[model samples]
Target: VVGYELSNGQRVSKDEGIQMAKIGEIAGVAVATRKGNEYLRSLPDENENNNLGNLPSITD
Candidate 1:
């Protein structure tokens, strides 16, 4: 994205990685279904990484 911006290519890389992550989540779902039984860590959930519990978003 930065490179495109520099060259004025009109293509954006900004947040493209974020988009790829979503696509990756879909891939993970597919793989988990065909390979074997889904496990806790293999599943996606809101509470999956909430080990610290609800906390502040920005402390600074």
Candidate 2:
């Protein structure tokens, strides 16, 4: 694992960086899902939550 300094001036382990990157990715997907759900809920449809089934998965 390669270590490096982040923009925050903190040294982070490569493993930690990988973990942080994964967390950020998951957060982004969650936000997208939330927004899509909100928009779908506002519409008069019975298929609102169905779109959530297509959310991206976090995996190696």
Candidate 3:
């Protein structure tokens, strides 16, 4: 999920994962950059879930 955001410092969220899945279904990497940016806008809060500390939020 954070693949693109790693170096760019964008971000990734659960919703983006969903969008990525849908976009990927129709085609691969098409408009993916935009989707990734959108995902970055709503990036997930690491502590939104169990608060395990540094744990990732499951999107799929």
lDDT per residue for candidate 3 within 11-53, as digits (tens), equals: 5554664466555532222332573464323234454543222
Could you estimate the TM-score for every candidate?
0.20, 0.37, 0.24
Provide the overall lDDT of each model, using Cα atoms, as 2-decimal numbers. Answer: 0.30, 0.39, 0.40
What digit string (tens of lDDT, one per residue) describes model 2 on residues 2-45? 54344455666645654664566212222223534311112224
Ten contiguous residues with the weakest lDDT in model 1: 1-10
Clashes of 1: 0
Shift in Å, residue 19, candidate 3: 0.4
- Residue 28 lDDT in candidate 1: 25
Name the runs in model 2 displaced over 4 angstroms: 25-60
lDDT of 2: 0.39
Worst 10 residues of 3 by lDDT: 24-33
Error of 1 at 35 (Å): 36
TM-score of 2: 0.37
Indicate whether candidate 1 or candidate 2 has the larger TM-score.
2
Top candidate when judged by TM-score against the true structure: 2
Model 3: residues with Cα > 4 Å off, grouped in runs = 1-11, 25-60
